[model samples]
Target: MIEAQGLTKRYGRKAAVSGLDFRVEPGRVTGFLGPNGAGKSTTMRMILGLDLPTSGTVTVNGRRYQGTVWPLHQIGALLDARAVHPGRSAYNHLHSLAAANGIPRSRVEAVLDQVGLTPVARKRAGGFSLGMAQRLGIAGALLGDPGILLFDEPVNGLDPDGILWIRTLMRSLAAEGRTVLVSSHLMSEMALTADHLLVIGQGRLLADTPLNELIARDAANRVEVRAVDHHRLADDLRTLGGDITLKPDGTLLVTGLDSASVGELAAARGHVLHQLRDVTSSLEDAYFRLTENSVVYRTPVPA
Candidate 1:
């Protein structure tokens, strides 16, 4: 497990991360989410001991990252795929990392095959495409067979096939009881992959909860209704204690009351109902609602 207590980082006058406290448990995939400049990368760096925190502490398993003698066997990470030596072959790169940690040479071939890079294992990493490079990085991370893994934008430059491959890999890793924490901008993919979510804004912890529960909170008490005259129904719904939003496509989104109550009220008013049903909120909808005040940048729509 990865644990952080009062984790904070400051750069000159800016606070990159402030008092972050969370735990990433084993046997599940946890997604780290934040807008640009929300200190996600800084937090990851602190967790990996790549950057020193101004205060607080972070630990993997039971020890600090820098205190471990064999970090490769403890936790695997892919913070930057481009950090690998460009002149070396994919096989050589993993071999070199394994050698540095006293890992046997045979482990290199196993990880290379695991990542499906064995076919091009001799190719120089400089010439590998972004997708291939991501695979190579993942191979290196798996070289040590660590129980914990961290990936930052692992699908940044991948095609659909590569993205699916990554999703499958993460799920498989979690199924094997490894702790997995990943950060990405793709909400749809995160919705499909992550069982838990850690959300941050302006370097502060905004939310830490299960993905389904977060989305369910907002979806509650919502009912979708369609009427012959949506505008008239909107007025009637308000009088019936229902908060209403008239969608552009002529659907009335109602809240503050259950579907049965809404239907009964509409029927009592002698109004013709075309449709009335509960509305389920998607992850994107819930994320926007939760982080509405946390966005640091906004672009005006083109006229």
Candidate 2:
């Protein structure tokens, strides 16, 4: 497990992270989400001891990560996939990291096979594609079989199949009772892969809860209805003072009302209903609603 209490960081006059107090427990995939410049990367660096916190503390398994005798064995991270030396072969890269950390050569081969890099083990990293480099980085992280894992944008350069493979691997790791923290901008992928969420904005904790709970709380549940008397139904729905948009496919998307309410309104109007279903919000929708104000930089759409 990973724990942080009053964690903070500052660069000159600007605060990068402030009082980020949260605990990431084992046996779960916790997604770290934030808008651009919201300090997600900085917070991860602090957890791995790459950046020292100006105040408070962060610990892995109740101890400082850097203070551990074998830091790699206690915590493994894939913050940057391309940080490897380009001159080294994939095998040589893993071998060097393992050697420096007292890991055996057999483990290096095992990790190579695990990440599907066995075929390119002897190939120079500089010639590898982005997807291949990502796999190699993951192999290095798994070299020590650490209980705590941190991955930053693991699917950045992956194809569809590769993305699916990564999702399964992360879920399996969490199933093994390990603490997994993933930082990604892919909201849809996170919705499927993560069980919990840690959302930050401007270096402050905005939310720390289960994925479903956040969706339920922030995302409005709308009801979709279709009937022969669409016009009358739309009029009745509009009386509820909710935003209604008619789809090109002839379906009415009604918000600010639940399924039960929509059904009752239809019944009250004595209109025949062909379809009345609740449409829950997607992860992207909830994320936008929660972080709408937290966005640091905004880009205007072209007319």
Candidate 3:
């Protein structure tokens, strides 16, 4: 498990992260999300003890990461895939890492196989592609078989199959009771892979809640209605409440009323209803709504 208490990081005049507080529990995947320049990487670095926070603290399993004995066996992190030595063979790279931590060399091969990098174990890391390097980094993370894992943008540069493989692997690790914290810009994938979310905007905690709860909370109360007389139905729905917009194809987009109410209004207005359904926000929609104002950088609207 991982916990951060008032974790704040400052770079001279800028605060990369401020007062970030959250917990990552075991047996579930906790996703960290934010827009570009939101201090996600800075926070991860603080957690790994790679960078000291200007203020506040972060701990893994109730102790600072640097304070733990055999820290590799307690927490495994794949923050950057390009951290490995380019000239070293994949096996040798992991072997050196394991030796540094007094871990068995056998773990090197085991993790290579676990991450599906057995054939490339003898290959030079410099020759490997980004996806392959990511797998090697993942293998190094698993070499210790730590109960706590942190993967930042694990699926970056991965193909569709590779993405699915990573998802299944992360889920399986959590299923085995490991505490997993992964960060990504891909909300759709996070929706499928993570059980809980820890959203941040401008280095501040936005929301830490169950996936379903976020969707339900951020989704607009709206209905999708279809009827035989589109114009008449749109007019009637507008009279009841809320603004309406007609899609390019046909259906009317309605807000401010539930699906049932939309149906009742349509029936009362003598409109022959063809289809009516509630339109709830997806995780992507909810994430955008939550972080809309917190994004650090934005393009200026052209005049």
Q: Which candidate gets the maximum TM-score versus the true structure?
A: 1
Best candidate according to lDDT: 2
Q: Is candidate 2 or candidate 3 better by lDDT?
A: 2
Candidate 2 lDDT, 3-78, residue by residue in tens: 9999999999899899999999999999999999999999999998889999999998888786577777988899
Displacement of the residue 76 alpha carbon in candidate 3, Å: 0.5
The candidate 2 region of ten consecutive residues with least summed lDDT is 216-225
- The local distance difference test score of each candidate is 0.91, 0.91, 0.89
Give the candidates in order of lDDT, highest first: 2, 1, 3
Ranking by TM-score: 1, 3, 2
Q: Which clashing pairs does model 2 show?
A: none
Cα TM-score of candidate 3 = 0.88
lDDT per residue as tens, model 3, 1-303:
889999999888888899998899999999999999998999888889999989898988888887566778988899999998899999999999898888998888889988888998999999989999999989888888899999999998788999999999999999999999999999889999999999999889999999989998765566788888989888887888857889987888888877888888877878887778878689998998789999778889899
Kindly give the number of clashing pairs for every candidate.
0, 0, 0
How high is the lDDT of residue 55 in model 2?
Answer: 97
Model 3 alpha-carbon drift over 4 Å, by segment = 226-246, 265-275, 299-303
Question: Which stretches in model 1 have alpha-carbon errors above 4 Å?
Answer: 239-242
